[model samples]
Target chain A: MNRQNSNKNNDHRDDFPGSFRSNPFHVPDHYFDELPGRIKSRIEQDKSRKRLFYLRPVVQKALLAAAGLALLIGLAIALLHERNDVHVYIGQFNGISAPDIEATLLPSDLDEYTLVSFILETQDFTGMPSGTDITDEEIKSYLLETNNIEPLILHY
Target chain B: MHHSDEEIIPLIQDESTREKGFDRLVKAYQQEVYWLIRRMVIDHDDADDLTQDTFVKVWNNLDRFRGESALFTWIYRIATNEALAHLRKKRISFSFLALEKTSTAAIPEYNDAFYRSDNAMRQFQKALAELPDKQRLIFNMKYYDDLTYEQISEITGTSVGGLKATYHQAVKKIKKKLSLE
Candidate 1:
């Protein structure tokens, strides 16, 4: 009966001539024995990779925020510096003493004609009484009465 | 560890039981996954790397598993995708080194005393390597893994009728290539 069964198996093989019963591939010694450990290590490595993945965006966001903060601070410093310059410029005029103001006046600004003309232009004549023309002898009498005359010459 | 997917999925889903459950899942499915990739790539180291890659994807994506398919099928799908992608890259980069041209030389000799000396096995592997990628996958899954059409369908997203036809065509091709037609 076993011989007959073997014959039947042979007949089956003959019927399907392309059937393969054996594996052609082979793995190294104890490959499966170490496969579990390798897989565990690979998993640990993958977890580390994932940790880096999670940290990357956070690091990028932090750097971006820091950059933005630095830019804001730089802009604020520039604005404050500009404001200080304006204040110093205004203070040059507003905080000066009278002597310093006179010291800063140009030679042309101190011209007698120019000063008198400026005074005449600025004075309000509406409160003053109207005056008639005065004679030179009247000016001389006033100077003599006030003892403000110099005796050098009425002829010149 | 040898529990059904019903028992395994919950453990993988729960944080407390997740690692142990994954270890058990790997222990159960590693051989199957390895052999599937091994037959597809025909290189041990490549197959091993692809196997690990497949499991890693499974570990990362287990939370999104909806139980629409069997756990093994889901795992197989991941393995299949890895193998096919690896092959696609290998093909493009090494197109000049087409396996069919050097199929005989591609058979690796192992360091063991148990090196395969069978001509039929060598011929079978060569014939298998000559098939198109999907046809080879169908043949390996159907003939070698003894996977059912429904299971293969779930893994491949191919219909049972289509897979049957593909398997039939692959077998015919292999038989003709082996001069057994």
Candidate 2:
């Protein structure tokens, strides 16, 4: 059976005319000589590329984390500075009287009624002059000196 | 000196001697691998590139070689796969064209003095070209490379009986094609 199969295989070869074994292909001279070097260079390049590929995302993540931390630090510093300014202003007000504090805090353009109400709530009336005692000229002079006449005239 | 696989494999497996061993390996088998690919691809440039690619793969995968098969067979397997894959990609990208035209396009120009006078050679090459890529591969291994069914089977991972049938079919087709021409 083996011999028969072998002969049959030979028969298939016998059917074809002429040898098909002759190589029609040719390469440039020294192609084989230079191929190893070329392949080595490619391997080296591939190794370098793979190293970079592994390292790239790590480097990028580290940089991103650093940038995010810097932003958080800056925001915290800004918020702390604003809070400190508020605290400083509050500390300065602790030493001043209520009238002085009201004068500094209130707008100069407050109307007479609002100003009187605010002072009545906060100040002592024992030493202060009454409205009937003060002449119209004295009131006008006080308003002028305080730069509050324009708002009073506009209000009226 | 021609280094055997026993000598080469050990050198390559060692990091210190790896490059030198690989260089020796390439020098020893480059021609065999080149011709194996050249016949399958039928174009010198494609074969050259595939041969280089095969060696690069061998280099990358050298550590995993368990010595279950001959190193030559392993290398041939790589070269074969590269050729078949190249042919497959070409077929897919150029599916719009007729198979005959696609195969003919791969034929080297007949400007060579040897090819210009040999009509039989040209007809035979054309017939071989027309076969399916795997069938053509089988035919080339048997007819040109003179590899046995057992060796071809080892390289191709095809059963011997199947290889025999495919090779027979290839021979019949080439004969018919030649007679028709």
Per-candidate Cα RMSD to the true structure, in Å, reads 13.8, 9.7
lDDT of each: 0.71, 0.75
Q: What's the DockQ of model 1?
A: 0.11
lDDT (tens digit, per residue) of candidate 1 on B133-179:
88989888877676777778888999999998898898778778779
Listed in order, each prediction's TM-score against the native is: 0.64, 0.67
In model 1, where do residues sit more than 4 Å from their true spots?
A1-19, A65-156, B1-3, B92-115
Q: Which ten residues in a row have the lowest lDDT in candidate 1 chain B?
A: B105-114
List DockQ, one per candidate, in order.
0.11, 0.19
- CA lDDT for candidate 1: 0.71
lDDT of 2 at B20: 90
lDDT of 2 by residue, A18-132 (tens): 4556667678899988988888888888899999999999999999999999999999999999999966864575477766756654655446655544434544445766655
Poorly placed runs, candidate 2 (over 4 Å): A1-19, A66-156, B92-117
